[model samples]
Target: MTIPQEAIEAGAQTLFEESQELDQDNSWDDELPEEWREAWRYAAQSALTAALPALERQIREQVAQEVEELKLNPKDSTTPHCVEEYNAGLTNAAKIARGKDQA
Candidate 1:
């Protein structure tokens, strides 16, 4: 199944911003260690990788519950569909971790 462009962009934005935060020291004048910054960036990126879909799942579940409460259809497909999306994220994360070209 195709994921939304907004979701991909949002995930990329979150990963980049968090990586930047991990690499910066606002209180400092000199640059951070190159090695350390790279390491931290990848670490934060991976953590975001694992977290984004899980976070999305929890949020989707809560919203689904709310919709069920109101006897309305939820915003998503079935649980298996959501799991497929989550697995896709995990697969993409692995590709990224391997430095594979997405194209």
Candidate 2:
């Protein structure tokens, strides 16, 4: 299944923001010049952008593997009750990954 672009962006943005917060909370960052901080952020964003495709591929592969295992040995009474439930599961997973949902 193709993950939504919005979900991917949200996850990436969350990660970037957390990194920034960590940097800010570090006492060493206070001595750093604004230029240096900006450069670090730029490099971080660039690295994340470059890694997105591989990250997405890995997520997809893992999800597919889990789905296959479920098909082979499903614990639920049904594979999925309906398409809406399946979509909800995907949406909920995205939310949890993005730190927008507790469960």
Give all candidates' CA lDDT scores. 0.53, 0.56
Clashes of 2: 0
lDDT: which candidate is best? Answer: 2
At residue 60, candidate 1 shows an lDDT of: 56
Off by over 4 Å in 2: 1-27, 72-103
RMSD in Å for all candidates = 14.1, 11.5
Clashing pairs in 1: none
Using all chains and alpha carbons, the TM-scores for the candidates as numbered come to 0.35, 0.43
Per residue, candidate 2 scores C-alpha lDDT tens digits across 1-103 of 3455555555544554577676745433257576655565555566667777888677766665554343322245466456446656665665554435545
